[model samples]
Target: MAETRKFLSVETISLIVAFAILAFAGFVTARTEQQRRESGAWVRHTLVVESALYRLDGAIRRAESEERGYIITRDRAYLRPKDEIATQLEKGLAEVGALVADDSEQAERLSELRPLIEERLEQLQHKIDIMRAGDFEAAAEIVRTGEGKALTDRIDALVAEMIAQEDALHRQRDLQMSEATDTLQTAIGSLIVLIAGVAVLAVLLTERQLHALRKSSESLKLAYNELIAESTKRGSLEAQLRQSQKLEALGHLAGGIAHDFNNMLGVIVSSLNILRRKLRRNEGGLDPLIDSAMDGADRAAALVRRLLAFSRIQPLNPEPLDVNSLVIGMSAILHRTLGAHIHLATVLAPDLWPTRVDANELESAVLNLAVNARDAMPTGGQLTIETQNTELDACYTDENPSVRPGQYVMIVISDTGVGMPPDVAAKAFDPFFTTKPIGKGTGLGLSQAHGFATQSNGHIKIYSEVGRGTCLKLYLPRYLEDSEAVEAPPQPQPQPPEEEFPRGRPGEIVLIVEDDEKARQATAQGVRELGYTVLEAESGKEAIRLLRARGDISLMITDIVMPEMDGARLAREAVFRRHALHVMFITGYSQHAIARDGMLDPDVNLLTKPFSLAQLARKIRDVLDARGDLPKGKP
Candidate 1:
């Protein structure tokens, strides 16, 4: 191949050079053609604008000429021509307006032209009428020396301005054409030079074949690195997606648990309340037991709240929470949890960036984690609680399965106690996977912590070694975003047993909008016992049907989570049908019934179900009071 290259004929080399020249010419030709087409479009647009202005100028001139001709002739024939001129001028003015109305300068000129045309037309018509009446001297005086002449002069001025404008535009177009031609010439010359330079470069650069390949090899390495980076990013995203899927699965699990637990709590509380109310009614004694049962029910409520927190199903009411303040607030609780033997030390990062997290949930996670740390050190060891800023990039997230690349405030709880094995630590966040004796420790502690962190848009990473110690890093994502001001808690309004809430009021028309058969009857029956006329319905459909039948209803009490028709839907139908209707929703699944999506009308009320007789009565009375005071709308 080397011998063949060296012995190449001069004629063959000439032929190669000629072909190279042709390729260069082709590229230049294509670019020139594109520029020429663009220039033609610009020229066409300028011509259209100029043509419109010229038409206006011509119309004004023709009107003035016709007026002068009629004044001089004093003939009826001149009157016909004047009318012809007026009609033609009006049509021309309208045509030009349609074309150049979008141009501001032109639009202003057109506005000026309007008054001139009106004055000139009126004056010329007066002169023409005089001329037709055989009053040549008077008509000529009006045309030449009166307001007619002034009007005609203004019209003539407008025509002159229009002509000047068009002439200026034509000159500008000529300049643009000259500029484009010059630019095209320069571009063609530069392109030829660049093509020659490329040809020379291609020849000179090819001489050192190995060196050229070496540079190409370096470029290939760079490209390979870029590909690896892209692959790594893809890998990191896939892992995050998997974590998101896991969390979604967890959300579903939490919802199911919350549903059953809420129902149990509801039953427990309701039954206790019913028993106490009955005892009071019957004049039976046993107040202490009743009080104890109430206390137990309250405790059960707290326990349910904790379960909801652990599952992250409970809405995170994140506020602008200060980390230092939170840690300080938790100091007493942490110390009490760790006990006297364990040396509880807190190393909070100074000027620490604050994160938006549910303060209550944060406190729970910290306290639980500290207690776990205390338990790990049976022989007594130091426990350090440290907080610092953390930024996880793609590289870091790729290695850590649960973590995503983002900002966080890392709260590490390190213990000097007997540490966990790697295998044990791996399953630390798995629910009910604890090594402690039965009844000693609930496996939900660490699991709950992990869930809370993830729920707060962060992750928990635990590192441990069998004999050394455990370092549990709880990454709570840094939330710097501002949220809308949380509205004040709705003041509980206990209604009198007469009007609004269907469950409490007696004699008031109560519309039961519950879909569940058992719940609907219980609620309707309980309302009826309160002396309020209970209207029963198993669904929103039946509730609405009942409501339509009765026009005297004061309040509508509906369970939001209905099968055929939800409470909100029924409430809307009720309000539309009966303008004065008040609504109060009762639901077992409060989140499902009254989520962000389930926005009930502001006039409507909300009452969570499994409520007591007193609660039911009070709510009804309060809602009724509010409804009573509302201003009446025009009938």
Candidate 2:
């Protein structure tokens, strides 16, 4: 064993020497590649210079040849060629000088060549002038007797000498390039042998690593498979959870719609019940019966209004309104709506700043919150709607991403009932997210309220504890504006028992454009029943088609939101085509779109939806009657 080990020393020394030689050879080869690149660039530049030199030489030759031809022919055509020679020769001299400018020896030679060339050019010019002046023999003598030929000879010699010098320089460059290329090839050959040995060693190392990696790969794959399986199971569970949450939210939203509908029904039934009793008592006056019917009509109108608001048909018109007035006005209705069981209370702060918000939407939101609070109570609890002033700052904005730094009117609705947990409270603003039992809510109330607040440039926050009551803070930014000079509720107008309209002339035409199918049909029915021609369309498309089909449509009623064309556009087109056509814009979303378009005439009329048979009759009568004076509804 000792002898065998001792023999390894010589082998190790030989290996080390071999590695040193390989490294030295590789270093030389790499240096040669850089040298080859520089040499190639230098050779390319020299070739470009050589080409330019040849161009300059060609120009010189053409000039000399043309000069000789002019002297022999004495023709203007020959003189034309000679005339080009001086310009060409000067240009050639300048070009040659530029080419050799970078080389000291070549530059000195160019300097010598320039003057000789210029002297010959001057002498040739004089000789050509002499010949042109009819002293042809003297010019011929100058050419033949070798008077100016001395200068020409000197210039031609200098050019030949310069070209020879350039040729020699080019030959030298080519030889040096050939030697560099051969040396580079020899170095590259040695480098390739060294790299081959290194590749063998690298392959030996890679095989060991590959064997180790293959052993661990199987274990990793099993673990990864298990992880993927577990993840798939969790994903399935999450999907099921989401589906449950969605269904629950739908149930809540459905309930809210039903609750509002039920309240409207109660109003109609109770008013009729009172009227029935009064009639049974043999009441002589018809005032009670008349009032009860009006009350029922109003209640039905309110129900439709709420539904439209929920369906996003109603537009939100934001304005500064005192929250105190809004709450007080709706407090009585909320009490009736929430029922006698839930205690509805208001805590309106004195001198509360008016917030810029949609008054109608805010009232609906308050009612929605109150109903939600009542439901959470289950039995009976105080549902307090509190209003206060709030001043937010950058510090508060940092804490709440949605809340900006500003002053706001905070309207909080609270209930002392089974409160929501943190998780439930956090998701309160999310549309269709609810904690109520099925058929007890329309998850939209809270979401609608939250959306209303946000759309009004306000913020909504929820605070709740499990088993404790929850408080909702709605922060509505304040607006600066003058308060309205509102009057007391006016006395009910003494309306006619039934409406009647005089028959119009046969040529009188009325056009109606409205978007809603049911509303359009109902409006058309009301107008037709009242003895006027009626046309109905579900969208702006049918209305425009009907409009284009006939010139007889005297009154046009179109919906504000139709598929292809909105009411505003239809109105504009109809009026432009027929100056006599009357236009009225019916819109469910008048809040966002009411102000725009040349569509509606200043005299054109607008009527909100869910209108009754009598209301429709009255509006049409009023709109048509006002048309006599070109009231806003007519073209």
Candidate 3:
């Protein structure tokens, strides 16, 4: 009986021990599950914070891009989304702030990020306001200062710091969650060893945990895909922006070409119509009409030349020049151009530094500026032309980023006339941008000057204010060499009637190659009238055949641009066949055909098209008489 009682006691103690072990295991599992739940919640919170940050960043980028688009295109469509973007930015920032509220480090980063964002927003709004006020230059200048970029970069850095902190927390929580899961599995295994039902329950819990893990992984993948899509969208926006800029520039060029060319063609066509009517009436007053027509033609040619200059494609003939001498020599012409009312004065600096530039282009630029000054003051005004040696320093170049710091010869053209506002002065150098009444200006004058200065490795700036006066400062790079400045040639007197149209020699055969039938016929007629035997061909291939068949061809005048065989290639072949053949090239504007790096070869003799019969006759005679003087090798 005592043995049975001892056995019962041992059985009861064993049962109690088993129950205690099961209770301890259950407590451990519950605690571990709770920890895992808390860890998952923190991880989700981190994701929310990261999502808010991304939203904020995207909103800022969109705002910046839209602002730039508005500035560039001046289209109100870009402004339509402004209010929505602003709301998004505000909401995103507030959400980010709320998400990071519990973490001191992240909260501090947010604090630092907020002001930069606000400042950037203010800058954007300021630029928009300036643009709305029609002060595009002021808005552009604000962009140039780089303050906006600085703010953005700072904001990005701070946001990155906040994100990094959140990532670190997320990693720590993930590790804690993993440890909790391992602990839960260990407890469940212990319980499974104690009871079969517990084993089944543990298996079910493991499957549930795995399912949750798969769901979490899918969420992360979705976020990653979203980020990638956003990146692609940003890239597409950048490409569109670049394309828009290109189209804008092309539009400006086309508008300038159309406006100037149409006016010139109108003049030519009107003069011809008048002449025809008068000839039908057998009128005696034909000289003035002929002169007017000729003047219109000359102006058309000059317009093309000016356009080339503005495009920086015209060839330059740089020579060491004393600007003072050039200005003094131009005094009489300036007086005639300005008229008797306008007072013109010169403040020439003695011992002024010399500059290397195209003399004819410089003269043209100066004449253009003077003409602008004259027009600015309809009644009367003082136009002062000044020259001085100056050095542009780094401080100046820092503000005017396009300029270089160096010694320069400065030509200052100041006028006491109605001045321009900041906005007008800003776009003064843009082709076809003008405030002058239609038909009064072509708007190419200042643009041509700007191009000439740039092509000559120089700079130009304008200073003006309403109710004040205007000053244009042209800075040409100083010539460092010690060579004496070339003396200005004396102006040519009017040609005598006998020497006006010098005729070509007898038996001097000239070959004319042009693609346009009318141009070719007119040129052939002009040469024949000059006493030269003319041979005409419509294409380069025909011209080559003519050159090969005729051994006595004295000169070949060809158009530069042609299909299949350009003038340059044709000239090469022509020279290959006849080594001593004299060639002259003519073009309305195709400098690239015969030019190298925007410079015409020294040996090339070129004449711009739309020439008078007298000019053509003179050129033909000169080419025939000057035979064997120029190199006959391929050019």
Candidate 4:
């Protein structure tokens, strides 16, 4: 078998060398032509500028000469020539304006020149008009005053300055053109020598390149296969990474919810056990233990509400609140909360602008920060709570991509304590990511605070350095009034009730519609204990049927979340049937289900779930008593 040859033949190598020489000559020729064109452009531009200036100067001089001729000889011919010269001057000015259009400074100079030349022409014409009217003395007096001479001299100076600028430009362009010509000539000679050298080297370089290319082609094929395998691995890893992240987020959410719920349950269980022991011992009052349990339930409800807020299911009901007033009101509680070990200070900014936010949530967030700060300062430290009206400008919003550029009311809480390290600080706002010992912290404080701020269209920033200190800044959007300042709400005037709330009458009826039988029975029992006749139904449709049949039913109390039909729809139908029927909504679902945009309808009453027996009594009594005041129609 014969081996295949790799290298090119002598004749083939010669052909490649010839092609290299031709390519080199072509490149040199193209470069030389480009340089010549560039030089020509520069020279042409310079000449255009120079010629425009020269024409302008000439028009000015001719107008001045024509004026002088008419003034000295009093000849009409010289005066006739003035109009034509004026037209020429206008054209010259226009030409100069066009020439310098690209250069702002020169264009501005041209603008000044036009006005100066026009003013000089006007003066010349003024003198000529006086002479034409046979007021020779006046014309002679004007010329003697040197006013005409001064105006002409000013015009001359301006034109001369413009011409000088053009001349300087022309000189610079000429030098460039000269250098380019020299470069072209030198490039041609160098390219000839380079072409011969390149032709000789082409054969040698081609042999080396062929060998290198063969090796590179083989290497590329191997690299391509490796790349495909690596890409497949990367794709699989990415899929795994995405799944891991989703699971991690789910865990964080579930863990945070369980942690808070467990704490509340602990309180309730302990309180219940204590109350039972006391009952067995024949204790007089178990109010405190019962109250403890109620408190736990309330906290659990609050946690649910906050979670809804974090999910953006519960809309915000922002009202104009004075930051200074809020800070002052919370100072007492903050002082007590921080304990005697830590010194609490309030630097309330006077006359701070009002901000729009949910006051309850704002208070909770502030309190959370204070508590966190207190925990940080175990031994003793200073905790400062300050409020100020601030503006988050474009630069700040740019750096902080989450923030919007606007006026904000800033609440800064700073603590001098053992600060968090960088890693802890970074994850401080991540749910269930706590640095505290087990059971010490829920880790939802900062996360809840962050959620509140973001949901309010505001921003919160945490600045902490290990062993230095920590500062939590909460920025809420400012409330702007269109015309007058926002007036403070009038204080309620004390008034006695018209009459005592009578105990439930025999005919007074309260209908309780709840899907869950246990909840339904408990609610009915609460209403019955309140001295009112109770009617029970397991669904909205059942309650509506009962409402249609019973005329004695004074009020309808229904659960907001139920199967088939909701309390809202039930209330609508019941109210339609009985125009005077008063309705109250109870809900275990999120506020969004029972309320419109987080605000209970003004005409419709609401009672949140997990209420104690006392709360249920009060709500039922209130709705029954207000029966006469309810709107007599569907709402």
Candidate 5:
């Protein structure tokens, strides 16, 4: 009886101890689970706050961008999303504020950020309103004050601080969640140890809890990955913005330098022409000096043209061109240019698509490439020019951002010469970059080609291997014809001898409008020497005044770009006053008056500056004689 009684007591004690252990483990697990849920909620809240901040920042940036675009372009399309952006900004800011309400520091940052954001938005709206009122200068003045930027910088700083705070909270919550998970796991282990008969059940329960924890961890990992992706995307956008700014600065620099240099060259060339004309009959030794000076001026003018081309602001005259026919026409010139040592070949595709491009620029680009290829093949090599119909799909255009997905006429120039390495080829099209010996290259050839291609809405790429030679592919968009009305390319006209200068007829008067004093005098003197009466004005207003006073003016040649009243407006006013007054535009660089999208309007009668006397004479004569107004006995 005593042994049985002792056994019963021990059994009861074991059961009681097991029950107590299970109850303790369950209680600990419940508490740990509660802590983990709280931590998870905090983590999600932080993510929400971060996401709202990003959206707010993005909305403000978009609004600012649209505002600037409207100010510059005055296009209503930029303002189309104003209401949508406003909504997003309002919603994003409210969400962020509500989410960060619990944190005092975050709430303080938000409070500071709210006023700045409101001020920025208000400033943006004010500038936009000013732009709408057609007061561009006023809007520009406001931008130049740096007030908007200051507000934006402060907003960015506050947002950064808020995000930093959220990140810290997220980390802390994650650590707490990890600790809770560890504690729950330890409690599960203890429960299994105390309850041996229900070991399988405890293990199964532990597995379920572990699975839930793993799923939560995965969610956190995914959120982290998304954050990393956003950061990377922002970095890429910043890089692209920097590149765009650099290119814009370079363009401005190139344009200013080219304009100034062109004016100087014009003075030298025109003065030289006047001096040569005054001494034409004498057999003086000055002929050689004059010829050399003229040659140098012409070379300088060519360089200026290249610079303009590189800046992508040169005036282009695009015509429907058949690439195959163009290649065939240039065969003789290519043969001469490549020399006898180099073998030139062509693979012209039949029935190729026609593209609209500036024929002269295309010819120049081809010549430049041929010269580069010849230099690459010092000893002698085969050069091939091929044409084909190509299609650039999304896959290709995705890799090349400058290109669009569409049909293109591909011009392939390949050389069996010494090729370029990867590093050298990468920068092959950069202006002023060259691998040739000094004095052998200007380094603008490839860059000019690149700019020309881009300006024409085309793309160019170079492929090379160190040992295998190089290939350059130029893609031009295919021209779409309307109603089967394809215009044939204009043939080149034969030039008259340089000595032949077409003189003006009796009663024909030429009025010259120029901004520069020396250039004006030089032009007036040249026109007078061409046997025509001349008038000069220093500005467009003066030119208009001249036109109002003089009704017998046969031709009014004006600079396209001028302060206050531009040439186009002046021309309109002049034509309104005198219906018969002929208008001509001359410019050191292209302006919006005569050019659109970097192309000269087809109907515009324009003459580029730094022109030789012969070119000037011919252009003037052509404009005068276009209406058959030339008098008898006029050369």
Candidate 6:
């Protein structure tokens, strides 16, 4: 028995486990490396194929364009680019052929694509040759036959097929790569778990042996220590894995919903504008109806904004603000919204630090929190808004990895309503995870608040119990540098009367470029009514042609999103030609254009969609009135 036990001793078992781990790690590394090489090849192949397809399309288009130019202007110089583009296209196709040499199916597709492109190019060349031969009528007849267009369309379809194949191949390779990565992660995780389990098992077996052999107490203690250490490490790793999974799920949700919602909102906003205008022109006594409609539209807009915030897609226009003052200013609105049944109070620190944040977004976040509290208390409750200057130390940051250790302005909203249970409170920040009945609440309030705080380099947390109360704390980083100076409460400026507002200057030709017909005509009519000469185009390309044909244009008011050419690109081209051209961008919704990540460009004047007629009038007046000497490309 003693001889048999020697082979199963703890030291021997440890050595065997160590060798197993090393061998397993080596196997995983080799497999991962092979998959990586395969993935890289697929990526390169896809890129080369895509590049060839685009070049082929471009070359075909150029040949047709040159054919038209020679036919129209009878200039042989137009034919020069055709040869050059063809040469480049051949080189691109050669590259793609080499890339797909390993895939027979794709190579066959490439084979089909090359001939179609050549055939189309040859047809275009034939027309040019005929035109150069002084048979203008024959060339014109050939062009009229539409044969070149037919051939080019066939070439495009073939190239698209080849591209689709490559894309499918790329997706396949990506899926394989993902599987490899997941496998590697699983192997590594399993290795760790195995090591911990083996260590615990060895310790247990060793302890049992120690007791049978009547070994020293110190030996038993050592074995127990090993088990405890492995268990603790395993628990930590599991917690981290769960956290990573949660974040990945949240990212998927954010990406899935925002774009479609924004587009629908755009249609709603534009239709609303048209309705409001028609109502104003006639005394339909529909003022209340319009106002009510506007209110609902505004509320819908707010909901969209909140969704954007939760997704972290909402851009921020941060400005320095005194924390106490911002709260004080909102106190009145907060009280009104809270109603008489709920008591509102503020416990602001006199020396609270100022912070830089998007004032409107911050105000919205506070209001959301208040509204959420109101819902929680149907029978009435005390609502307190408190602000304090505080510092988060290393100890706090260590536990909350998302938070930074620095000076922060803490805004706490407390309520005496029935608080959330521990389980409910845990998931309070998840987007659209609401507890209220249908149509009563959007689970976005807390999520948006959380997103805003984090994006602004701050943090947020919640504390609640089943019945006692609830408190939500928002930690926003305090401004450490020069900030907005504390000033006396501002006096409300009287708005200019309807007739007092600036009107468009006479003969100041304003170009309106908008893709939506309803939106474009509405804008054009509004500017024309303002006494300015207005030129309207439904696309950016048309606007460009107009810009070139007319030099009297003083302002270009364009929607940032359009087909063929976007407003920004148009403005850039227009500005390049006319450096003093004034441009204004308006958009209903976009993740890009005139703004990035919700922050508006200071250099370009911007007006959001669903704007009133008065707002448009004032913006145009302001742009035209300003010294037009600002640098170009600023938009």
Clashes of each: 10, 28, 0, 0, 0, 2
Global lDDT of each model?
0.68, 0.68, 0.80, 0.76, 0.78, 0.76
Instruction: List the candidate 2 regions with Cα displacement exceeding 4 Å.
Output: 1-313, 324-354, 367-386, 391-407, 415-418, 421-445, 480-635
Look at candidate 5 and tell me the lDDT of residue 518: 78
Off by over 4 Å in 1: 1-295, 481-635
Candidate 3: clashing pairs of residues: none
Report the lDDT of model 3 for residue 562.
65
Model 2 C-alpha lDDT versus the unseen true structure: 0.68
Candidate 6 structure, TM-score to reference: 0.36
Once fitted onto the true fold, the runs of candidate 5 whose alpha carbons sit more than 4 angstroms away are 1-283, 484-635
lDDT of 3 at 607: 69
| Tens-digit lDDT string for candidate 2 (503-537) | 44335555666544565666666666667766676
Candidate 4 weakest lDDT stretch, 10 residues: 489-498
Query: For candidate 3, lDDT tens digit of each residue in 576-608?
Result: 899889988886432222242122453577765
TM-score of each: 0.33, 0.32, 0.39, 0.44, 0.38, 0.36
| Selected candidate, larger TM-score, 3 vs 4 | 4
Q: Against the true structure, what is every candidate's RMSD? A: 29.5, 25.9, 44.2, 31.2, 42.1, 38.7
**Cα lDDT of model 6 overall?**
0.76
lDDT score for residue 531 of model 3: 84
Report the poorest 10 consecutive residues by lDDT, candidate 3. 590-599
Q: Which stretches in model 6 have alpha-carbon errors above 4 Å?
A: 1-283, 286-289, 482-635
lDDT of 1 by residue, 1-635 (tens): 56555665554565467567757676766676576666666666667766766776677666667667766564445445656777777777787677666667766787898878877777767766776788888876765576866766776676667656656766776676676777678777776776776666556545555686899999999999999999999999999999997898688557645654565566667667777787878855556657756766775665566566667787788876777788888888777777788877677788677787888888888888888888898988777777777665543465566666666787777776677765788888876557888547546778788878878877877755455466777777666544322343212233344444344435687777665576678777777877888777777777777776788888888765445555666666677788787767664322211232224432445664325556677788777778732211112
